[model samples]
Target: MAVVVGVLAVAGALVAVTGPAVLRWWRPRPASADLIHGPGMWAALRPVLGVAETERRRTWLHLPVTVGEAGARIVLRLPAGWASGEAGTRAVDAIVTGRLPGEWAAHWCRTVAAPYVEWVRNAAPDRPRELPKSVEWMQTGDPLKIHFGETPEGPAFVHTGTATPHIGVSGETGSGKSSILYIPLVAARLAGWLVTVIDPKQNSLTEADEKSGIRIHSETYECVMAIAEFFVSMMAAEKYNGRKYRGHSGPDSPVGRLLVIDELPSFREYVAAWWKYIIRERGFPPVLVWFQLILMQGRSSNHRVLVGTHQFSLDVFGSTMARDQVGTKMVVGEVSIPSWTVAYGAGAPMVDYDETIPGRGVISLKGRRRKKTLADGRIERAEEIQYAYITPQVSDLLDACPPAPAWWDAGAMAPWITPRDLARADSAAAVKDFLPGGRFAGGREDLTPDTDTDVQLTQGSMPRSEAMSDVSGPGAVSGVGEGLAVADLVEKVGAEGIEEQRYTIAQACAVGIIRKKPGAARQYKSAWIKEGKPFPEGEMIRGNASYTREELESVFGTPEEDADSI
Candidate 1:
């Protein structure tokens, strides 16, 4: 009996020692969405969360994760002094990021829920997404719904207006910033909304104006005046909130009125210089005040801003409020973590920025309201995708946008611009060259290319005539302080044969002389070129031959009433 008892005791000791280990090893790991329950997550997070007993409770015991069709959101119970600060965020960021088990992380995309407060993640793409036609998205039948890029399911769209407003595009110098900027510019242009590009660099903006019919303000004073004019429009609307209204998002852009600031740094520099001049004369910082107002109040009045920049920071905006108000944040290519933070807010997605991919970047839209009570409200990518289209299609879309009704001229958008004339500057040289038929460059005398509203507002109060006069000589220069653009013959033509300038047909089309399409202009130009008449071989605007403003004028002769139309 004693021998039997001894054997039994030995067997019991071995079982006690090996039983828990066997059970732990035998425990079935979560195969799929079951990992969202957090029971199996501790093993993956142990290195970051620690091996302490308290850590296990803080994670699996208290962590609450819910999964849905769109994504999974993770919430945590806060301990004493343990808020969304650095230490807590670092621990949680690991929880929602790629740090999760490969199978689990691959199941969902990671983005912040409230930036260090709570974190939510979106589902990963199941298959490769194909590039879509830019024109198809344009025909979505909704003016406010714009197709920004592509996703796994198909074209990824961002909605403008009340629920989600404003957009921000950031990238390195060569990372497709211009292409992404063109997305909204084309959408707003096609919709026949007033599109304004406040390009401080002034690079190709004149061409952009000629092609897209967007308002351009490159100089500091002109930009400030443009902002002020938009603010005036905001005031004309019914007020609810207290905010000035230059229109938020220079790349802003409301649905009807868009203000695109291609370079935030240059724009701020321009504003600062103007501030010094205005403070000396007007005793107040009048420039960015209007901008801040729009950033705050313009949403209710349907005025929004879209900003595009190579650099980003709260310092880029006049107030922290404006940065907070930016609802749509998109970052393309490889950018620093801090820049991603400023662009997408704190605890933004930890996305890999691939520079080789054309327009490869992450985008997040704010105001992600729930569709149903149980539905996920996070409406953005957890991973990066190509968010831009090819540049070749812009000119065709520009032409297809079509002209506004003939009766709408006098009642055209406050700037007196029509749909067909959308891409042309009001002071078109083509109009000046035409004979008596239609009023060429209608109201161009009232609003010059340099200034928008009365310059009296720019420098306290000056005479209307002086405000309207050409102030191009001295202190009028903005950031660069020197003219980089050669004197355009388009501007020089029309007056006493304007220094005898020659132009290609494409140049003439660009300056609003002929249609941007290839049909008639190409045939006419080829006929002239075949005769070998020393026709200064022209450049191609859209895979078709072009002529200078003078040549197009000589060949096309302003098309009667269509003289000012591009």
Candidate 2:
């Protein structure tokens, strides 16, 4: 008896360490979580012994990793896909066995039966692209495709492009809410639209800092209000100016089509004034609003909001805005809270979701189908791209024109004009020098011709060289005279557009779109058309309105074109 006990103890110790290998035939091998590198032997074996050979690990565990759900029986090779949708409802409709607790049964349905529902979603065919490029917050070059569906609340696609529409995507933490912001932002930038980011949480706009397209702001109250007012003022001004696209905007007009706000609830609580202003003054094209949660009442004709939160409750839903405005409600995870039923719309049935599945976020389409995973995995969050350098080529392109008043440092420009109303032109002849199709009156915006039009134009008529000259400047032009005041010329020419155009030009200059000459007042030097080739359009030939340069110095009174080069 003593000898037998010693042998049994040795066998038990061996099973503790090596039992997983024997059970490998039944258990999946070497599972990993994002937080921890490898699985424990006991965890591996427990599932093997609990499940039969036919059952397999249903979901891939990444983050938010957990031990197995209670009383769940795994099954292999379930009939899945669209055909399985109805069949699944019929086949797995067993009442809970008395042996298992209610909570255990609930968890089992989520873990074991939920995959069939996910397979149904995956089985559906892909949809066509709705927007030009979906925006991606993730570094992975994927775009968020805008989609819609049919339901009693209204049609799904009804609010596709506009912000007056709002959507609700809810899930627990780390379930891909932040990763979702990138797709719309990328789409906005690629479309040449601007983004006004409102992130009360500092991390919301971190990825956008060095990005080319949008503007990001972080602060409480004051800064937020200022941005809100700016958007409001812009929308109102667009209407006030009656500025339609008209198929032509003269390369300088305010044409904004989108607004993006991330972390909406914190922004609302901390910067309520800004939030109120944004909703009330919804003149900006449309908004893509995101949040852990949202409770807003105001609605504007031009704005659309997309709210995301972990909680699905009527009490938190608050205002009528949620019920009326929320055209789509996507719920993630199993039905834990009964309050969610109200938000799903009247008489909508509650359904369970498999919490163990990775990338599985429940989306409630109109009919309230059971919660399932995306066809792809959970939307992974991406790291932000770093932009360290600005090339000189981009610098020259912006130098050709005067920038807007808002960006001009008033103290820097104190010698020029009032800060309240900064003007582009400080001199008369400066107008004729910079405006394209000019040497005529009324700057670039006019059809009016002047007496100096007869003078051989400062810019030559050749295509490549002329375009280059326009970019490079009067210095390269043959017979060009000195002291032309190119800066004054650019400013004068820039004044013709509406206020927004003027402001845009100023901001472009400030942002380094164009290069400016140092030590000279508003001197136009070169435009960044392309690398190495500055100002290929035309050169500033300094012959007066009278003299068409014949032999260079004889016509312009200056020695030679190159001599005047600044």
Candidate 3:
């Protein structure tokens, strides 16, 4: 009897130790079958799916249901004789019409190896409205990431790369295009890219330029000049790299270049003149030619373009070649069905155009597939996404970039002249004389009636060579001629001397030693004496400004003496 009592005590201890876990495992809060394949759902779906009783018993197969915290998913396989397409479509229609007992929705119905229909019953709620805390930059060889919107899986990101070089962004005026554009710009800047913006509207990217130090070209001429320079430089770099541009962050390779044209339609209007000059007169292709070139060859060179417009249409893109080159398409706000069809092509998922949200949109990466190990990976297609807003920290991060060259105003050619005229002038040495410092000279060239004349004068009645030469001569201190170019002034003073004094043109202007001329180009004026003298702090003068060599010496000190001090 004592032995039997000890055995019973041991059994009791085991039971006490395992009872709670066993009960917890067995207890069911909910079952996927009860939520998904319950009698009510089957009864509601049978007639709608057009499955006769005999056919349902013979062909319809119910796979295992997946239950999550919010809802469950039911997958149904159809037999060989049954038409999966008609059945899947009908089932989705019924589910959307509220035929089920609970709220039901057809997530997706795909026909892969086997024909199957998947339905969700309260599977999940809409993604929460939250913005990214910070912007993340993509690494070299990594895909470009744009935080678009939220999805059931999590925050949705639209990625692009060499295979998907260009992106087409379309939305209405206030439909968060700025938010979409800002995300990528900040990301690119953070990654140490050179971002060139052509914002015809001007207002679209003002905040980014002001806070992020992004270069925004608002004027038509400015855009043209910026694009021209970018194309020339990229072409030069490509040629230098043996016609094959390798995208690596090095002194020779440099960082990537991202050209963003906000409102392409408006920009196109302004580019008509430039197009005529470059294409008709110069025998080169239109501006779109460069765009096409970049689209085709730029991928390898880490050069990309993003064009934003209010409408996504073939006509807006000017040609099918240009439109088809864009590999990624993003549409936001309320878009018409026709527009959607144009943006995404056929086989696009049905979108509820009536249910419009500000930042909500669909994005598709063409010819891209998710990397999956088993079976063929799913193709990257259009899906809903929410874009992130620019935060204060992101703005600060952008602001930290070093100041870029004033390229917009520095290298622009006169808008009035044709490309042929400019070429001829250049060959005649007229162009070189007009722009002596290899930068923009705002003053127009005074072409004599005789076309054969090589010497071109400015409106101010001074020959270009004479003015440049005068600045380089000894009498420059006494102001022998018109104002000298800043490049000439730097050369005269010697760059090393100027560096020792730590002086800049802006500083000189602030100190009342130099004056800035008003025009499309940047020019400075000053009057110098043989001896150094100080000017009044608050003095302000404006006219045909000329700066004497003595003024430069007074502000920057003698080049030799300054070098010695250094």
Cα displacement (Å) at residue 261, model 3 = 0.3
Give the C-alpha miss distance for residue 560 in model 2, angstroms.
35
Q: What is the lDDT of residue 123 in candidate 2?
A: 24
Residue 403 miss distance in model 2 (angstroms): 17
lDDT, residue 436, model 1:
12
In order, the Cα lDDT scores of the candidates are 0.52, 0.33, 0.51
Better of 2 and 3 by TM-score: 3
Candidate 3 least-lDDT 10 residues = 446-455
Looking at candidate 2, the ten consecutive residues that score lowest on lDDT are 380-389
Winner of 1 and 2 under lDDT = 1
At residue 227, what lDDT does model 3 achieve?
A: 59
Residues 1-566, candidate 3: write the lDDT tens digits: 99999999998998887776675755555565445545565566566566776554224534234443345555665443455466656665564335344555554434466666666666454654443333333223233765655543465655666475677789888887766776667667766666778886756765565332245666443454455544543444444345354343333443467888899887886566444542223443245555556666666656677889887687777666667667777877778778776776545554543225456666764434452121222233666555455634456657665543343223233222345544543453223432313222212221101111111222232444544454343222212212243335455455554533322333333233433212211221112211234532322222122344464555545556645776
Clash statistics: count for each candidate: 32, 44, 10
lDDT of 1 by residue, 1-566 (tens): 99999999998988887776675756555444445546555555444433455565444333333354444545543343333446745655556554443233322222444222344455564665544423233446565777877655455677886544788888877787877777776777677766657887767333355343455755555555555555555544433233664434432232366778888877887666655664234444454666666778777766678888775587777666776567677888787878865665454457654557676777774333332221223234344556756466676676566443322222223432232332232132122111111121111222223321212224323433343233233212211111111124345666584554543442343345565322235445535654665554555533334355555655556656464554
Best by lDDT: 1
How close is every model to the real structure, measured as TM-score?
A: 0.51, 0.34, 0.51
Ranking by TM-score: 1, 3, 2
In terms of TM-score, which candidate is stronger, 1 or 3? Answer: 1
Residue 447: error of model 1 in Å?
A: 2.8
